[model samples]
Target: MDLLGGAALALGTVVVVVVGGGIVALVVVARRVRSGAIPRFGGTGIHELTRRAGTLLVRLDDRLRDADSELGYAIAQFGADAAKPWADALSGARAKVAEAYRLRHALDDAEPDSDRRQREWTLQIIALCEQAERQLDEQDDAFTRLRGREVSAEGTLRELRSRIEDARARAAASRELLSDAAARFAPAALAAVADHPAQADRLLDDAAVRADAAAAGIAPSGVSSVSGILAEAEQIVHRAGDLLESVERTVRDLEAASAALATRRRELAEDATQARAEVESAPDPDSGAAILDALRELEAITPLSPADPVRELDRLDEAASRLDLALAGSRNQKQRFAHALAAYEGTLVSARSQIAVVRDLVAGGRAGVSARTRLAEAERQLAIAEAETDPVEKLDAVRRAVTHARDADALARYDLGG
Candidate 1:
């Protein structure tokens, strides 16, 4: 009897320990579910649950980041380290329940009457959400997992397929650009290879890799190029899709950047407005004249077009998306923003060149050469800038051209002949 009782007790102890562990795991997962944390198909329960310190949660968070912009969204997508559908449904339901709770709680503060009905309605939503949450539990062992990178992850994978098609157009464009660039350099490349076979071979491979990566990293909506270039570009494109880490990072940075831009813009606009108001209120012609003369001198020197300032502001607006995404998702946007700024700097350089041409022509008595001529020159420069494949090199060329134009015009106006 002593032996029998001892064996029974041991059996009971084992059962209790097993059951207790299962319960604890279930409870933690349940809390995660309630907090809008879905067990990512491949992500550890706690690992995927916490918000990434910087860019880890980009995949989950960037749902509505750029819902209304030009770079908006690619399309329906997927990923590797993604959870199953039921989990997503649960997460969505959890979000709705959270919203419902807030609405219901607010009901208690209401004056009365219909507020009760409102609270009751919210309760219904909570019930519905709970039901959906239960479905997540039911499907637990039935789901599959994938690698966690954006390309292979579940959610990102679906997204990848969708964006892949969209990327088709961009890929095509890149291919064309690469082809032209390759063709242009082919003679030089081949000749070098002929002269220094080993060196040429190495340079060609390096060139191919660099060009392809660049195209991939900055895959525009449409482009066309060669097969060799395409391969590199594809690899580069994948870089942006690296472990949804980039997405999360970009989203976070975009948030802060967007806020800063908004604050700065508001401050600048208000200051400018107030100063203008003061100037108008004074009603002094000489003061006005002084200001206008100052304005004229500045205009003659820089010709700050009404359109240019607006373009910069518009760029900020467009960039605000990157910001909203950072706030909502994840990304390393400073680098991207920096790249964009550099691209624009090149554009501004070209515009300054045209302004210089205008000044020079007027000064040198060549202003009568027809507006068509001036427009033609400006248009040609724009075409060249657009057609050039290497962003850095093309930008450099524009900067150089602009500098030359500016200097020549300045000389013509103040020193050369005038």
Candidate 2:
């Protein structure tokens, strides 16, 4: 077309046809909207989600503004995202929806004070539980030591009882010997009192009598020691008669005293045996070694792996507290020697058990020699403690000695030979 004129004519025809098609399309869209004949939002992916949510919120807001009573406000406050329309709507409404989502995300990201408080409370409760458990373990150890002390007290009481019984028996035997010495006058006194029962009773009851029978020639008289002299004569006569008695009677009393002595010795032996057994069965072990091992293991643990050392450290603290309690209560001269021996034996037992299962640590002979030296030192302390006089002071000294020995052991080099 001669350029511009041809182009203008073609553009006018195109513009008219475009205008007619746009009018028809607008009319069809209007009819569909009015009749509510459009497909549901979920039926197609064509709907603008933000616009729809805005329209729903606007309607929800309108309901809030036109409330007949307070019921509408309550409903709006507790409305669910599922119940509201999420179809096309205005720009401001869409922006509001976007802002609500942003607020929800921000709340999710922000650390709440409530959550931090809950965590703090949880930690505090856990700490309290641990403290209680440690206290319980301490009490258990204290109870065990108390029982040991009770056993030791019982042993001491038994020794005192044996001494008392021996003293009583010695006193009785001395009396019997005195009686034999006094009975010598039985023959002479009996003949003199043959017709008088009262006089005979007096002679037999001479210890309690205080009459002048000895001066009247009823018996041999001695003013300086009348009772003694009379008793001596009676004892002579009794001895004479005893000499004439059968050997079997003498043997019988002798056997009884010997048997009593033997029974006492046997009972003492049994009590000693029982005390040894009680200590040997469940011997107290050192808590330090176990704690060290647990610490080593804890050093190797990683995060989020469930091998947290918090609980382990708690157990170790509990063990340490228990040991402390046992040490506090049992710290005495009488038990210091026993405690040292127990500690040494515990070290040996632990070493042996560890050597059986683990290698390299003790296999190099370094740890073993140091461990042995420590055991020997402990034993020496035990002897020293036993020889001490003051119980509390002796225990304190022993504890210091043990601590020093442990420090030495930790730093010492191993030597297999002298």
Candidate 3:
């Protein structure tokens, strides 16, 4: 009996030891998990952080826009002196949001970052956006209080009425400009601003209705009661005014492009003459062929007929550039550099024009990720080229910009159904 009791005691001691060891292991594992040494199943990792950052970025951008509208309303009603602090806060917030966007764009680029680095960038974006939100919230609270103070409703109504009259006149001018553009250019070229006149009219109508509402509400409660309505009316009028102005600007750009087309044609003729001289002196096959091609392209352009000036300019610049490159071996170093410097200007212009077109499509959500990435790169290269002092390097940078711009354009058009 003594031997059996001793055996049972030993087995029970072993069981206790084993159970304690298991519990100890579990405790260490839990600690590791809590400390992030071992990731939890649904952890806040890079992917999660990226998604949250994107969402927060968009929300912060929208808030900033609204804050801008509020600032404008505050200034118009209470004057710039009263709105200075809010404006300062808004400026700071905009800076923060812009930095966040820059970081996000970097992460979205082709180069891949390690998981740890990605997490750091995403966290920074979230932090910047949150800071902006907090700053805007504080200003918004102060703005609300400011709105509650007494303001002159009668004067505000008078200002709004005058603005509405101005907007109406601008809208009329925009309609006429659109008619002129329609007669001169293809319908597709004016698609961006085609509805501006009608949209401005609609906004004006809404502003009128809100202005009338504010006028009615002003006499009953006070300026505080109608303050929001007045702000809405003012903002709508501003939007209408902006739309009308954009139409005028677009038309002006088209007219400037027409003038530029004529100027560029004359320049191309001069460049072709220079290229012919170079080819005749050196007798290079490629140079001679390039000059002929460039001259043919120049002859193909008709200034009198309806034309896409930007496209024509691009074609002429590209042809001239090819001729310059072909004759590069024939020209002296000084002449080559001079020609490169001039060619860089035309290429830079073409790059900027293409980038602007792609950026607009991206803003309209008609572009995909590929297009956006290329556009970002193109802008970066163009900036570098603009700051470059070395003629050869600047030319190289501008050519890269043109390449990326064309790629973005092609991708964007493809995404828009080819």
> Per-residue lDDT tens digits of candidate 3, residues 78-98?
566667777777767776676
Best candidate per TM-score, number?
Answer: 3
Best by lDDT: 3
Comparison by lDDT, 1 against 2, better one: 1
lDDT of 2 by residue, 1-418 (tens): 3322443354456445545564453345335544555333333222243344335445544542332233223223222221122111111232333333332333346665353232322232222233333443443454355334333443333343343344334434544543443353223212211222232233334422322343333212211213323444345333322322212232232333234333433433443343334333323444334333433443343322222122222233233333434343324454554543433332222222222211222333456655655555655665565577664445544554444344433434233231
Model 1 accuracy (lDDT, Cα): 0.38
- Give residue 379's lDDT in candidate 3 (0 to 100): 97
Please give the CA lDDT of all the candidate structures: 0.38, 0.35, 0.73
Write the candidate numbers in order of decreasing lDDT: 3, 1, 2
Residue 249 deviation, candidate 3, in Å?
2.3
Task: Please state the error at residue 362 of candidate 3 in Å.
Answer: 4.1
RMSD in angstroms between candidate 1 and the native structure over all alpha carbons? 25.3
